[model samples]
Target: MIAYVGDFGLARFLSDVPQTSLVGVKGSTGYIALEYAMGAKASTQGDVYSYGILLLEMIPGKGPTDDMFKDNLSLRHFAKLSLPKRVMDIVDPVLLEEAKVSQGSGNHTNTRKRMHACLISMVRIGVLCSANSPRDRMEMKDVVTEMHAIKDLYLGVRIHQDEQVMSQLSGEDPSYLSYY
Candidate 1:
């Protein structure tokens, strides 16, 4: 549901077709595939790779930067090298809020535990989708499934907690907690 609009001038139209294609030997640079930069024909797979990058940007609130790929460092390389730890560092603080509320009561112990678990799952999915080898990356359908599951679980937990708070506010007996 997210869109990244880079310079359309960077996109070129083929003489024989109406469809536009990315220009320059390097395409858009930060999120482009190696095949695109190498002059191989761009495919949906290339777009999927860029979509993966876009997904990362949505979660982190920062698009890929030239610095991410500098010093022989590609985003994929950095993510893979760091895996769960450093990858979590780049996650947006918004997710931390969601994770905390998802855990209920906002207790530090519960929030930290839930956030850690959610973050780990998120990093795993992101890493899979952003694999350096396009063939190794997941299909869009699989990505959709995984993302849905994460959202469902996170929201489901939060909703249950909300119901509890509502019941308490209404002065309903706490014993009713078992029903929800």
Candidate 2:
């Protein structure tokens, strides 16, 4: 499969031929969807599962094959178990530190809250997309839409923060707060 980044910064892959079953499995071990191992054909659903793994990896900065994923634990389960709570524990330390620094500059309670929500939503999408059953996984289009929504929320908060900083620097009225 050939992969390229789409306009939304999402990776899109193209397969030259239609779906078909091969004699044997071929793909990175951690990324190959479970169905393929069970003699299922190459499919969009498999691709979605791999994409989900990719998304999950982004949160904790750990690959599926990481040493920590031995035994019953896996990247998917690790992320899924932390959802809606314990996000900070699973999130990358660098990101948490960066958030702390950003929160120090101003009244960042709103910023912190928005960021937390975005993180939870992202982990949820990853978990949904990587469900064990292909039928349970989200479609690629829906994943893209949900991702865009999260991106918008994140960027909105960032933009507001930037404007607030600018206003403080320029001694302008705090009118930008009204827009958010």
Task: Give each model's clash number.
Answer: 0, 0
TM-score, predicted candidate 2 vs. hidden true structure = 0.71
- Tens digits of lDDT, candidate 1, 89-176: 7667886676566666755654454444444455555556666677877777877876675565444455555444333322353342
TM-score of each candidate structure, all chains considered together: 0.61, 0.71
* Clashing residue pairs, backbone N/CA/C < 3 A, model 1: none
Give the alpha-carbon lDDT of every model.
0.54, 0.68
Q: What is the Cα-based lDDT of residue 180 in candidate 1?
A: 16
Those runs of model 2 whose alpha carbons end farther than 4 Å from true positions after fitting are 1-25, 98-106, 157-180
Scored by Cα lDDT, where does model 2 land? 0.68
Candidate number of the best lDDT: 2
